[model samples]
Target: MRKLKLQVQMTIDGFVAGPDGQLDWMWIPGERDESIFEKVIDLAESCDTILLGRKMTREFIDHWENVVDNLPDSPEQPLAQLMVNMRKIVFSHTQTAINGRNLEVENGDLTVAVQSLKNEPGRDIMVYGGANFASSLISLNLVDEYYIFRNPVAIGKGLTIFTEQKILKLDSSITYKNGKVIDKYLPV
Candidate 1:
């Protein structure tokens, strides 16, 4: 079976985004690391399909498709192209339609949908979104791996690590000098 991976950039305090949904704190200001960004692009390429929550899907697709054109060419452009080309499955209750190549809208039981996708023949499925969706997947015990880009700064409070009703167990963790940590967990 294909693995389901949640790849997110989070703060030291465990918030994916700030209270106002701002992610400007993620990368260091005036810092450009092409190698690290390239690694992220490579990870994106390894995935066969992407699972997104409603908010993430809409905002990402819109920005990458429209806004990226006006911005100067940089490493972000390649990453945007990868997102456009990959097959996407957006889970949303309010979203009625989706526009793009190989994109699908899913408003049903997340566990069922994810399980069906995992059973299909392909590379690993990647999940990118807020803690709500991640919590849902964790509750279902469906997530196989987690790739967290832990930033240096900490947000006192914002989004949580997981919003699931049950507690999860961490299996292993790896630390990087860039003040990033990758924590892996096993579903009980």
Candidate 2:
């Protein structure tokens, strides 16, 4: 079975994004070290499938497909291409169809759909988010790993991590010298 990993960039205060859904407070382009960004790219490359919430999928597809070319040569291009080529499963009731070649729309029950995918033979699956969707997966104990890029800034109020009914226990956590902390948790 393929591992399902939830990868997110979060603030010190545990908010994934600002109250307005703005991620401007997180690490900007100049603030990131080249080595760290490269590492992140490599991490992204390991996944064969990307699981995304509707809003995130829409925004990402718009930017990666349309706006990537207008930008300069950087890591975003390669990341965008990688995202475009990989298999994408966008979970949403409103989205009738997913627009790319390897993209698929999954509007049925999240747990069943994800379980079916997990049973398939493939590289690790990546869950890129919207907190509500992540919370659902967390509640169902479906996520196998979490790769969080913890930025130094603290946003006092926003979306909280683990917005689910079940309690989660951290199995291990590693803090990097660059101020990014990666935490791993297993469902108890």
Candidate 3:
């Protein structure tokens, strides 16, 4: 069975976003290090499927598509192409359908949907989250591995995916030049 990995960027204080869903505190183009972006591309290369929440599906697909279309010679192009062509399952209860070639809708039943996907023969699955969706998956113990990219800054209050407070076994970690640390963990 392929694993389901939750990859998210977190602040030093453990929040994924500010109180109002603001992400401006994160290091952007000016401060982003190439190695951190390369790590993200490496993670994407290991996954054949992307499982996302309804709120992020549209934007995520669009962004990757734009990258593939416009950045043909850039270092991120290969990952962009893979993301654009890879199978994407967007979970939503109210949304009945998704209009795209490689996109599909999974009813918001996390357990059944995730298990069914895991039963399939394929590369690993990765979840690029919206806070609530990620929290739901974590709370249900559905994530097999976690790739937490911990940035240097701290946000005192905001939304976090790790809501249930379960202990995680640290698998590995890498620190980039820009003070961004990627911590890989497994549920204990």
Question: Which 10-residue span in candidate 2 carries the lowest summed lDDT?
Answer: 66-75
TM-scores for the candidates: 0.85, 0.87, 0.92
- What would the per-residue lDDT of candidate 3 be over residues 77-155, giving only the tens digit for each residue? 8778888898988899889797754899988579988998899997899998989999999998899999999989987
The best-first sequence of candidates by TM-score reads 3, 2, 1
The local distance difference test score of each candidate is 0.78, 0.80, 0.87
| Model 1 C-alpha lDDT per residue in residues 1-188, reported as the tens digit of each score | 99998888889888898887788888776555565577678778889899988776667788776635666565578888778788989898888688866689998888888989999998989888766777677767888877777788887878765764655577777665565666665555
lDDT of 2: 0.80
- In model 1, where do residues sit more than 4 Å from their true spots? 67-72, 164-178, 183-188
Residue 49 of model 3, lDDT score:
92
lDDT of candidate 2 over 61-138, digit per residue (tens): 777776456665756787777777888999998877978657789989998999999899888899879887887888
lDDT of 3 at 162: 77
Ranking by lDDT: 3, 2, 1
Worst 10 residues of 3 by lDDT: 26-35
